[model samples]
Target: MNLHSTPPRSGAVLAALAGAQFTVMLATSIVNVALPQIRVGVGLSDGGTTWVVNAYGLAFGALLLAGGRAADLLGRRRVLMAGLGLFAVASLTAGLAGSSDVLIAARAAQGVGAAAIAPAALALAMGLFPSGAGRGRALGVWGAVSGAGGAGGVLLGGVLTQAWGWPWIFHSVAFGTVLVLAAVAALIPRASSAEGGKFDLLGTVTITVSLTCLVWGLTTARGSGWTDPGVLGALLGSTVLLGAFVVIERRRSDALVPPRLFRTGRVAAGNLLMALLGSVWIALFFFLPLYQQQVLGMGPLATGAGQLPLAAANMLGASLAPRVSRRIGDSATVIAALLTTAAGMLWLARISADGSYVGHVLGPSILIGLGLSTAFVQLTALAVGGVPPQDAGLAGGLVNTTRQVGGAIGLAALATLAGTVTTHAAVTRTPQLEAVTAGYRAAFTVSAAVLTAAALLALLLTRRSGWQRTVATAPARRSAEPRASAVS
Candidate 1:
């Protein structure tokens, strides 16, 4: 808890770190409910409007690895402050942007800042609380903030847009960024970077472009036909770039993501699980709001407000995760959390157009919420648990990159599937509302299936090679293993 043997302000340091995470996440999702006003103000076409969201996502997702590595080579604390400064500037620019393109560019700039901020912030937090109950509690707080940020964004988006205007959304984020910057500068201590090595510029460029292409292709595929020439070209280009990146990294002594990082099964497995969780997580956020507004005929504000239950439950579950992990081993905790969330998704799949929010949404939200945070907390620990200190920032970046990429890809696939289902239903002369509801049901059903599969994989992956070693506080692990014993 002390951050060091002599830190006098542990709470302040943690708060500063959490604020950084929350602000970046808030900036990401805060644009959702304000899109209508944003579109009108910027004179955006429907396609252009979607790009507002996609631009931020693209830049943020694609450059995350580079950002993470920057932290490693340049120092976590240094990169964090730099990122926050950029974020504040970008947010202010976005608030004052006069044209659609300018706004989009500003958002992309903000994404770049967020990419740097998120990984550095997490790495700093993990470094602060090295082990034991303190580490577990810190992760719990981190996960809870991560889970709540999106929901809070939606709620605030509506509130600000209605009470003030769309520009206020960006302004508010800018204000938050400044405040977090001050807190972090004052509270957090300086940390060392990787001792020596040139940054992997080649690997960075190739992987960044590869990810950008991949995410763009997926986003485009969801809107335009997958067979569209541009989409196909983007996908093909991404694959080629990715292959080249792999070959390049293997040759480089100073790789952006070293091949040896995956030597330990824990890092590999943790990332895979995070990807799976991210897929379901994206689908839930994307579909749930639309379900409330489109199917239930609620307004934007109402839809935003509806998410409160889920947000609250998610934070509570995050708070509870460490305690549960204390009782059950880390792997078991992940398995249980996945299964619990899967059950919630299945319950949600039973939704009807005629159903009320209480029956169709509220119950499932609570159940899913309980599972998501726990899984996220455990997966973070598993991914970075034993990574060498020099590679901690890179490890953080890699884990986050997988989650973002997985979410983008998964949302595209699920959305495509749902669109197909709705079209087919309409062809059969189904009611509009019913068809939409059925499509949502299909997405949730498939999500539940995916989560169940992930749970089984987590069990299998950990059983053969113990995962307890990766956890922060592996009290549930016995026989006085070194990693298990070191924490307590």
Candidate 2:
């Protein structure tokens, strides 16, 4: 309520923002754990079942930037609140749905709401906190959600699906949305729309079409083939659309994604790392649940509980990352984090149907969670730290854009890998549970390899002479004046 306070009630705003983020994340995991029930309930074949997840992901990934720009045009608080409202409506629709088509449509709506909310929430945080330890700490907490909230969802979803039913996942979302909506309403400050610029309708349409086509093609290519006409056409269309987007933006005086930001080595490298690391992050969170339920024969509640350690460790790692960066520099900290995460993924690949949770799952979960949190915090800091105030929303959008897009691509690729492995294992035995376990292991191996490559890339990103300072100190300095005003 006190607008003149030096801190600008950031803690309250963050709590509200994080609540929104947590609910969305919770929905994602809860639904994933209940996928089997939904598949059967809706009579979906294997190919059709994947759309349950992809529908949301495609919509969310495609529209993220447009959402951010919407925030600047519409007012961050307004767009965020609207997003929560839409999310609540979608949750209700999803909960009450009687068919797969309805469910997928509801999920797509949920994704659209998430696309609107996520960037606005993040941009508001940056706006409220600006520079220094305050912003770093805030981003650190946000980074932990990428791990902690994910872990919690697994546990919660498992219990809901096991004890109640699959529909309970949507029910849970509805309840959480009500709470988040109220909290955001009460806690978030009024934000004035900073719009005088024109919206890039063309860019938005092209990018959305491009990403949808690309992800759709990739997801389908697993069941079909790379040479499949639909896949080839989609891929080719995406490439062309992306090229057109580039050309359009270049011609525009105020483009959706300014080419100037790419000139900053830190921004470019951070976006790349966010995308690459997102691949590993998505695979670990998505598949690990399936691995536990399908291969390890764990019940939903037990599977969810099993992931708590990793979630807790992710929060711990986020808390520690800033200090690590302060001491060793961002480059070294990122390298160390990436390597640590890769090692954890490699260990995860050692899991078998016969393996014990303590011996196989626990340690790797902790390691991967820690690694992801550390890298995510650094990447976020690097992306939004320095730049003119006017470009903050765009910068934040780009950071998240890379992440969501990366996640879609990662899921598709990992799913394909897992499917191939499952098929190979089925060759040895019928398509039984044990065969599925082998496929899960193969997917884990690929996940490990992806993380290893990400680690190497993070090393390269940070090792550039100017990149380290950009990651560590520049954003804090760049936003100092505006932050001081916003806070004061």
Candidate 3:
């Protein structure tokens, strides 16, 4: 699973990896549509219902770096298998849970498994294909499936909740996990450990706790204000822990994340772009649904059905991204994609209370879906472009971590912004629907501006060669992968 080798079984390998990722993304979104049924089924309080989602996200985001590092150190195949087993067990437990506590705990366990699975899957995919066009095409397929997974979850959740029950959603994921686990075992070749020695312990613990505090603080800030004592305490605690992590990394030869990785301009710039794009991308999903349901009065099924066009366009754009990247280079293609996404956001900002779905939502959704997927694909590829074999897992984990963190920050801030706008509009004697629509529009406008800033920054970095212009192909660069180790 390295350069100059394409096994005949590559398709099966890709499917296994992609399916695992699909499950991870699907698990994140599906619960939203079924939340009501889930609440009644488990007798959850409002806070408990919210924690059902937050539990998964907090664990997923917090442990991702450690998961990726584990993949490298423990061996990708072993880690993926173990993760799938844990995911399957958790999914079943969640499906069978009769109490709120059990369900939330199981969801957190699922996230723990997902943190391991996501990085391991991506790292293995990278290993299957060589650098340049081969890897780009594989990544395109990865992007396509990932986008479809998220959209599909919304649709599937509604259907599952209506026809079967909320538990079926979790059950479905369990079934899929079992299928992919079998495929992975049969198809993927076993990988060797990155090195004989163990990974850094203190650094891992510090960073994991730091990230947990950061995500928890952000999650809490959505409901509680930023100035709330708990939120402030958690944020301050995270900052302190992060500082300790940096000091430990700098001093340790076997750092949890090698200090030199950040010095690579490609990794640095690419992840920065990822954070920016992910913020806007996540907010789009959140606000769009609220606009559809609350403003336009669409039911859950209709809302999910309406997103079919968006999902199709996303897959189409992802499929086309690799070819576009090859022709224009990664930086140029990413810049163009970002601009396209910004334009879509601006178009969506024109949403109105009285507007029809076909008239208002459809066109902007197609544009956003196409441009967002393309941008995500190219930027994701760019993030891992110059990394050596040993760093692949870390790179995979880093990109996913940034996306999750960005998504959390974006959703919380945008929700707060929307609420503030709605409150102001209501105070001014605007009608309820109109005021809410105004808030949605404001969110979209700000999202467009953020995307524009991302595009501008990418353009500036490309011109300055802060992003390695030839990193996409990587033929000229030496494979400077340092030896890494397994944690005991």
C-alpha TM-score for every candidate: 0.95, 0.94, 0.94
Error of 1 at 178 (Å): 0.8
Clashes found in each candidate (C-alpha, N, C closer than 3 A): 0, 3, 3
lDDT of each: 0.86, 0.79, 0.84
Q: What global local distance difference test value does model 2 have? A: 0.79
RMSD of each: 3.3, 2.3, 2.8
Give the true-structure RMSD of model 2.
Answer: 2.3
Best candidate, lDDT? 1
lDDT of 3: 0.84
- Give one digit per residue, the lDDT tens place, for model 1 in 1-488: 12454456766878888999998878867888788899999899988888888888889999999998988788787889999999999999999999999999999999999999998888887776666777789899988998889778888887888889999999999999999999988876554323456899999999999999999999889889799999999999999999999899989999999977777789999999899999989778888878887899877678778889988988999998888888877888999999999999999999998988987899999999989988999999888876766677888899989989999988999999999999999999999999999999999999999999999999898976567655578454322323211111
- lDDT tens string, model 2, 1-488? 33335354667778888787777677666777778888888777887788888788778887888887777766677888899999999989988888888988999999999888787777777767666666778878888876777788888888888998988888888888889889888876564435457888888888889888887787778778778999999999999999999898889886888777766678888888889888778777788888787777787788889989999999999988888887888877887888888888888888877777888899999988898899889888888776556666667777878987787788778878788877887888755776777777777777778777877877766567277674344454455365532321
User: Which digits, one per residue and each the tens of the lDDT, describe model 3 over residues 189-237?
Assistant: 5554353346888999999999999989988887788899999999999
TM-score of 2: 0.94
Question: Least accurate stretch of 10 residues (summed lDDT) in model 3?
Answer: 479-488
| Model 3 misplaced regions, further than 4 Å | 1-6, 192-194, 465-472, 476-488
After TM-score superposition, what is the CA distance of residue 360 in candidate 3 from its true location, in Å? 1.1
